[model samples]
Target: MTLRSKPYHWLYAFVLIALSAFSVQSVAETSMEQTGELQLWHKISLIFDGPETSERADYNPFIHYRLNIIFTHPATGDRFVIPGYFAADGNAANTGAESGNKWVAHFSPNHTGLWKWQASFRKNRFVAVSAKVDAGVSGGFMDGQQGQFTVSESNKELPDFRAAGRLQYVNEPYLKFAQSQTYFIKAGPDAPENFLAYQDFDGTFHNDGHKDDLVKTWEPHLTDWKKGDPTWQNGKGKAIIGALNYLNSKGLNAVSFLTMNIMGDDQNVFPYVDYNTYDRMDVSKLAQWEIVFEHAQSLGLFLHFKTQEAENQGLLDGGGTGLQRKLYYRELMARFGHHLALNWNLGEENGEWFKNHPTMPQHTNERIAMARYFYENDPYHHHLVIHNGIDYDDLFSADSHYTGASVQTHKADFSSVHTAVKRLRDWPVINGRPWAIAVDEPGDAQHSLVPDRMNPAHNNARQNGLWGALMAGGWGTEWYFGYANEHSDLTAQDYRSRDLFWDQARHSIAFFDALDVPFQRAKSHDELLSSAADYVLAVPGEFYIVYLKDASHQPTLNFKNFSGDFEINWFNPREGGEMQQGSKTTIQAKWVHKAKLNNTFNLGLPPSTPNQDWVVVVKRK
Candidate 1:
């Protein structure tokens, strides 16, 4: 009667036993339900009926049972083994149920064709936390069930992730969409790290008495919510959902939020049902989070899941990859990893730091282990990065598992942004793999990015933080509000407080989009400029972008290594508009040495805005 002796017979007997275990009425109930638009890059959910379990059960449904769905594209033989989760009653957000027989898995098919799937449900003492695929004995109901579905082409257009496909790390300095092959450059918020500490979520954090004052209502953004938007529990999520709408309206493509912060700065955010309960998860709270996340994807916003902060890095498994860490990561991947664009940020300021108390630091081995777990477990294999408290020198080597770096620079004027970005871009060359660098935190902690009423111009932010990162071949930036500023990182409810600054960020993104140049292939060549203060990013003889931080510093390009007939155009970074003709419309390049004659081509002045920063775009015509 062993499973291996006669596999098909054993499966049949298992099914019969499972059917007898439940009443005839329960056995007649549908075992599985499929939902969502069955199209390419759209989420397709498979909800199955399993053993009825509770979040507070002695068997711990979160860690004692395992569900993995093996999905295969018949055409290309591309298979994705996606993880599944326990969904209480299959409608926990609306019903607020604590126990049920529902288990679910989500899949976003990358190709448009027939796809086959099979469920593998297993049970053991602690099988959910194990990385092994076949870690436990079979649990019968839908264990051997097989099915097929068809995915058609998506009709979604711009600003919808379905139109662009998944944003993947393709061994470049930037992430590119799989469908469009368009390189991505993000601009968004990096502050309010406790974004999930909302009042509507189902958790005990509001009354936990640990930084309960930091919980947010997100009241100001309720007006931004439009008709046909998604909400839950008699319209409980409008304010938070509207905040995402405002960010998209501002042309921001990315957002950063923390999932767990038990002992961190704002302790009101965590995924557990209770503060001290780590093994059990609040099913309804997580379901509400999925609603917000799904809306963000539809709006084309990248999710930055900062798993922990430095203060709580050691709260689970003492900063090692153990049982607690595995279960936490498993729940996240199962529930939200189906989104198109996201990066699993290991931790914010991951290393040791001291403000009022000292935090535990994860050594190089521990850090790599944590990253390796996600790299191997996540079915999508989305971009992986780690924020720095000190630096990323240890991860610059060839064995590193991270695809990018979430940088934090400490400069009030953001003067160090360029150097930090350039260093990350250059150091990884020896390993033959470049890390996509993003300046997530630009300025100092006390006065990073102030409100528009405080500094409407945002001169330093535009000149140094925005343009500086772009000119140095950095992918993008996310602004972090200083703690001392109004609407600071932890307590901010309104996004319009930095209204003027969002315009500046939008202008920068617009300039890049309008040019339509292959900037992803371009590299930083600051040494080619006459003034070291200015910056030059070029694809050698193809296209060039020269950023002049000060309009007073008239610089020239060293055309000694390049030769072509080039057209020069001027652009205003502060106020985005059409490209204007500069003082010099054209220049003929010829090879000449610096030691010999004036081999440099004078870029000349901008057509207008002579006192502010300007970007000069030169292209071979």
Candidate 2:
């Protein structure tokens, strides 16, 4: 039916939500022959988990989401009628195991909406009833067998259990949150220091933050305490204090305190413990963090409260049936909304988790979504991020718009993140957001692929744009990788090498300060490489940056549509930034680069004789 333009004009408002759950098994795999190298599986999965309510936390991880699907054809019709296709689709498993005959749906009071759903298996069909999804605020539908259960209105006021933190959204307090590095140590119900032998801080914190602590790691006073002696723990605290005070003493702008329930029994510093919510002590920032943040403020350090999530080994005895993941996070953000010192660190080394248990994806999404949620809607609006392991390229997807990307990658973990950082930078998924690498390598961990005492790794990553985010308002934190020796009665001095490494890591920091770079939000360009070629980008009114794969022989070739007087600043990863003032404009200079470069310019370098790559940043003419 057609209506007159003015005759039909009217104001209207409505919301309609539809919940349809269906299960589909892998159909016969379609085999497509390839004439070239084979790449497979374009199967995309949307993730979900059981309702994230603390009450069901005993059965459901409060931080988990179901691997659910809600895909719209955008051009809806027969697509809606497909058996396994629903407005909201999901995996058969709720959290751990598959539910034979159940699904959840939500519908909003809507109009002009017509749809259909199908399933490969009959039992996977969805039954509907009214339930309240407090977070989504959409009317919920469940398997018809259970009837309907109403959430007591009073229960709405019940506290939403959450990670330790204060929410800061857009510099406002709209939510609460937590951050921690406990995945590297312990979890849930113990003091963070108990499980770890010590911390490793590089020289950047020197003078500005932990400079003195870098010196104190070698100070003989730390070993004075012994087991069964009150002084033993006191001595550990002293060591911690020395390190912390160094940050206070330095003019460093911010801090992230390690907050988690991890048990430390002296000798074995790097062990995970099991502790539930109640079993875990009140070591959360709610109590002790205030003092730390306050002290940092007096010394002028932005306080960033940190915590971690359900790292399995660190006992999570939180036996609740329902927990409001969103509200819990909001409450944390709301609690500490006003403090600039609070940043939401969802987890450390969490991005590295392999999706072995694919059905448990919602849990993964929930954890990841925790950071996404915090960064998206928090009040404090402080920097919200997740700690990605070295394999960031595989795990970090382009979702969420936040402050920056913080990573924990060592030499061992750092398998050419160029592609990963490329995705992190230019992948269609994540438009180029800021990126930072918080290196904690060459430390006390004996098995480190990149040892803790290795300081060059620190500067190398920094100068190479791994930590360039630091230059672009990107902030990085360095931890001295260490562990307590439980088997050795805590007498092991495994930290010396790394301690010395931190003392020397300052060279990188000083290098960063002197270099002219944009870490957070710099413009990037795409160009083809030929040194054997090079990838080069010429930023208008700025520098010409180039990243070469192999620097065998240097040839100044022709640049299409490029002519100007340019000064070349070749990036020497070994010696830092060196500028070679080109007297003439036909620029051909030997330079080094990190992650190589976003721009690939052709350099007439010989075939794979194998020379380390370099970057040339041509300053403004």
| Best by the lDDT measure | 1
Best by TM-score: 1
* lDDT value for model 1: 0.88
lDDT accuracy of residue 87 in candidate 2: 13
Compared with the true structure, what per-residue lDDT tens digits does model 2 show for residues 276-350? 232111112222222333333434344444444324212222211123344344334433443433456655445
Worst 10 residues of 2 by lDDT: 181-190
List runs of model 2 lying over 4 Å from the truth: 1-238, 245-257, 261-275, 279-286, 296-306, 309-342, 349-365, 368-377, 388-404, 408-413, 429-541, 546-559, 570-616
Alpha-carbon TM-score of each model against the true structure: 0.94, 0.45
Number of clashes found in candidate 2:
115
Worst 10-residue lDDT window for candidate 1 reads 21-30
Give each model's whole-structure lDDT: 0.88, 0.32
Clashing pairs in 1: none
